[model samples]
Target: MRTADFHIEDARGDATVLKLTGDWTTMGLNQAAIRLGESLRGYSIEQVDLSELGRFDTAGALALVQASNFAMPANAFDTRPEAGRIYAMVETLERQSAEPPKRQAPLVRIFSKIGHGVHDAAAEILLSMAFLGRLMGATGFAFRHPGAIRWPAWVSQAERSGLDALPIIAVTNFFIGAVIAFLGADLLTQFGAGVFTVQLVAVAVLRELGVLITAILLAGRSSSSFAAEIGSMRMSQEVDAMQVMGVNPFQALVIPRLAAMVVMVPLLTFVGMVSGFLGGMLVVWSQLDYGPAFFIQRVSEDPDMGTHLMVGLVKAPVFAVVIAAIGCRQGMAVAGDVESLGRRVTAAVVQAIFAIIALDAVFALIFLELNL
Candidate 1:
């Protein structure tokens, strides 16, 4: 193919005629485009003669239009319908591109983002409400048909989420308890109130840290697992297969995991509390020389610690439900792609953790109002 080139024809009494010639496809035009553009510089074209134009395309048309400073004559391609259409298309595109973009003010951009975020949040809340309704309906159905309940699945999830998670939960809460004791001892000792470290550990562990730690850990673990597991099933078409066979995917996949989570979280919280107490006791003994008997006795004297324990325990099932719901819903929303699965899994973990902390704050406010 001949490379695209143009020639300046002899002037016609104040008319500057530029004749475009040779193949004008991208392969040919791309090489000569710069040279042609430079050659046309400072020349005011009154007419463009395309009588010898060959192999026209968008790239060549664009090069010609740009080189002419976007002032191609209307009748330049009157003899060639093919090149005319291409040039016309390029003209429209170039004209649009030449227009400056409208930009918003800085404050407007900030408020615009805020408005969009609020709207998105409202939409997500509505979606969550609908999902919760469907989950409840599935739960009621499983309750009515006890035999349909996948007890094996529930037990399997219980082992994976509850039993398997225990060792880590215990170790984490234990260290947290020791840290609290260390901080308490460092502070209280200055005031000659180091003995109060026992109460500090009890109140902290039984009231908040134990449940919060367990919930957060599970949110990162079981919640992400649920999303990934169900997402994989959906991706592999197993979820669709279950639906086609008249088996409720929700009943088969979600409920058992939900039930397991609800039952197991409270138990885990309890274990975490005991582990925290033991850890704090060891710290107090080593630091303040307070014996385990004294630590236990001090904790026992505060019957209010029982109320705190109840407060923590009550949050466990709610946290569990939120985690399971977020995870399963994200999984169900996954598209048929690996990217979608990864995004959904990440969203599940983040949303579950956020929901847990926010719900805990709400609980604290409610308890404070009740003076509990």
Candidate 2:
């Protein structure tokens, strides 16, 4: 086959005419393409002549179109209708693809960004509410048909999220109690009321720190775990397969996690409370000369112990619900990618922790208003 070739003819008006020749097919086009660039450098072609062109194909059409900068007029290919059609198609596609998108004005861009943010936020809030409703509906289904409950999964999650978390929870609360005791003692001693440090530690841990710390710990550990587990199922499309099989993903995946958190959080909080008490009691007995007997006597005589402990325990179930809701909601939001899963998992932990703190503040306000 003849090799593809090109030569610049005399100038036409302000631009030159690039005449192509030879078998302008794929087999002969590679060298012609490179040479076409060098030969046409610093010369703008306003037209192309394909009359002598032989065996032209898409590759050759592309080379001619590029060498002429896609500016060839239709009449330039008077003797080669097929090559002209190919060149026209390539010219249209290349010119369209090579054009850049228009840039928006700065003010328009700012408003566009804000609008996108608001839209995304609204969509997210709606999705969260829809998932919450699904969870509640699943819960009602379980209540109406107890057999729908996944007892094995619930037990497994409880053991994992609860029993496995005990050591860290106990240790964290213990140090917290010890630090509170030290602060209370140091501050109270300045006012000649050092002995009351035991009461300070007792009330703080029992009323707030114990349950609060447990909730925060579970938010970090259990919330992320729940999101990751369900998000993986989502990524693998196991959740979709369950749906195809007429299985409720909410009851199967979400409820077990919610049940696990609901059942285990209170037990964990109770353990945390006891650990805190022990820590503070020991610190006071050793440093402030307050014996175990004196610590117990003060804690028992304070009528607020029962009320405060009840208040603290009451927050456990609500906090558990928040953690489970945030975790399960984020999990269900996973978009079938590693990046999506990671983002949802991180959002689960962050939103759970923030909700817990905000809810704790609300609880504190309600209790204060009620004089409890």
Candidate 3:
């Protein structure tokens, strides 16, 4: 039919004429199928005639076929040429709709995904172990990739992570130290041990707080930045581009970041130590008339100086690893979406900070038990 106005008289006992006049394509067929199905409902209509259907397409033919199937199984269906065309159209429409949608899965899909993840992770670990074994066999290769040093990478990283960070790290730590001195002064004054503020600032800054604070700050500044930068590169397909050009993304991106963090954290720790000491010196000299020399003397007098310095320095690389690992892992995990990249980078920063704090606490407890 040229128009949807064509219909059967007294059909379904409703005394309505089914009209059909449209494009008669997939979209049209869908509309016809829905309307026909609705009209058939709660009605005794057993068949339809479409002999006046002057034109029909594959979609119209399919819809007509489906109508016949539905009517036949439930009731006796009379077929006319025009009616047959309409029935065929509906049949095709139903078939097309019945096909599943892509990327649509069941409700428990996440569990299936998790199971696959566990399997993949296990397989990856096993493969890595096997590769390590092969490396062991290749003594020359292992020698070339020695665990002890990667001097060129280290120097490059030190320039980027440490040298570049110096000014900000120094300024921040100085303020932090000043704040601690002010607080320590007030607290110690109440105990008639005001002079001991020097010891409090010295030991706390060097032994724990200074390194931990510096690490946490860097984790925020550096780790999150690394994740975002790499994630953007990943989204733009630059990482894949590099791979296509025969460049190692890990060596080019990850190694540099990891090396930089490792080199910078120690130097930052040193900066923090100096600034914190200076901060405390300011408060002691200005408020208490203790003088810079007096505060320095108190630090020098501490017999545990070497132990405290060693503990702080040793924590640096651990902090660096946490920062770099979180950044790279999250960056590499990024999917194609901008939202996913932002979320992962934020998570990386938070995870890195938590890891740094957790590791610092563990090391502190361990060292305390060992009397370090």
Compare the candidates by TM-score and give the number of the best one. 1
lDDT of 3 by residue, 141-247 (tens): 43467663456766876776677777777777778888888888898899998998888888888888789888888888888878888899999999999999987
Tens digits of per-residue lDDT for model 2 on 1-372? 888888897765676887888898889786988788778778766677766778988888787777657656658777777777887887878877855779999999999999999998899889888888888898999889998788999999999999999999999999889999989988999999998898899889988999999999999999999999999999999999999999989989989888889999999999999999889988898889989899999999988899989999999999999999899899889996799999999999999999999999999999999999
Off by over 4 Å in 1: 1-42, 46-58, 73-111, 369-371
Alpha carbon lDDT of residue 341, candidate 3? 99
Q: Estimate each model's TM-score.
A: 0.81, 0.75, 0.63
Candidate 3: TM-score?
A: 0.63
Q: What is the alpha-carbon lDDT for the whole of candidate 1? A: 0.92
Candidates in order: C-alpha RMSD to true structure: 4.0, 5.5, 6.6
Off by over 4 Å in 2: 1-94, 102-110
In order, candidate lDDTs are 0.92, 0.89, 0.73
Candidate 2, residue 370: CA error in Å? 1.3
Kindly report which residue pairs in candidate 1 clash with one another. none
Which regions of candidate 3 deviate over 4 angstroms?
Answer: 1-143, 146-156
Q: Could you tell which candidate, 2 or 3, scores higher by TM-score?
A: 2
In terms of lDDT, the poorest run of 10 residues in model 2 is: 65-74
